[model samples]
Target: MFKNSPYTIYGITALILIILLIILFSYLGLNLYIISYLISINLVTFLYYGFDKLIAGFESVRIPELVLHSLALAGGSPAGLLAQKLFRHKTIKTSFQMTYWAIVILQIILILWLSF
Candidate 1:
């Protein structure tokens, strides 16, 4: 039952696509590869949130919050926020919100520090 879930399919699809992109990007310059990786990760992250929301009421296993946060930390926080608003998922839970915001803030700081 769990293995046949749409989320599993999504995960597999995303993984395959990401791997293919990585292989393609390897032939490209580092800057281009970095950009492609970021875009892919964000797209995957957005889909993950939507999928998690879709499965919220079902008995099927939901995407773990840790995975969500890890994705955001991997540079998908903007997509995470967009997905939260678009899917109306993970916006109300105070604990989750706090942690998410913290991650965002840290990312912002890291970016600013790097830009200096």
Candidate 2:
């Protein structure tokens, strides 16, 4: 029903991520502060993506790629991926995608190292 609006995908992805996070945290007994931080960072990253998309439509000054990568590295890569897909932004840029995936991989490695 939301064929005309990209927001449907964004909302769905956010909801699913939230649910999954809750479940995973419950299973792992992770700290509340980390959960809160992830939620806040992801929200900010999603807004950044939305803002960047808006500016792109108008040919206005855009948010820097470094800033975007920083946010993703700061625990927002899942949100970044969702935003990229939902907004159809930055997905076509191979360099950006490569860097983004690298950030994701690094984060995964960090998480694994810390979990042990």
Candidate 3:
């Protein structure tokens, strides 16, 4: 049981340590807002690209076409919008373009909501 479970055991231990650290920091009254924001930024980029690939299918080089509005709903819209526009890979397709812009608008609204 222990042989094949080594990697899983190590991973679980690391995850527990991280959770403990988070709990300790919060207990100590440390604010994690900034750290959370930075982590979100990084995750957004990765998620956007991943979503794109998922939506496009395996054969398409343009990446999968994930639901952009949904991603934006989850705080990854802005990154997805920027990446799609800059890369110009999925910009021309009617479905992708439309959904991408729709997500952009949604993100703007979310930003406003968060700010106020």
**TM-score of every model?**
0.79, 0.71, 0.45
TM for candidate 2 is 0.71
lDDT tens readout by residue for model 2, 1-116: 76634455444544565567656666676668668568766877888798889889786656778778877987889999999999999999999999999999999899899999
Q: Which candidate is the best by lDDT?
A: 1
Q: Write the residue-wise lDDT of candidate 1 on 1-116 in tens digits.
A: 75876556655666776667666666665457778888878888898899899989999778878778877888889999999999999999998999999999999999999999
Decreasing lDDT order of the candidates: 1, 2, 3
The ten-residue window of minimal lDDT in model 1 covers 5-14
Instruction: Report residue 91 deviation for candidate 2 (angstroms).
Output: 0.2
Clashes of each: 0, 0, 9
**Cα RMSD (angstroms) for every candidate in the order listed:** 4.2, 10.3, 9.1
Candidate 3's TM-score: 0.45
Worst 10 residues of 2 by lDDT: 4-13
Pairs of colliding residues, candidate 2: none
Q: Please report the candidate that would top TM-score against the real structure.
A: 1
lDDT for predicted candidate 2 compared with the true structure? 0.79
- Provide the lowest-lDDT 10-residue window in model 3: 60-69
Q: RMSD to the native, candidate 2?
A: 10.3
Instruction: Give the Cα error of residue 5 in candidate 3, in Å.
Output: 27
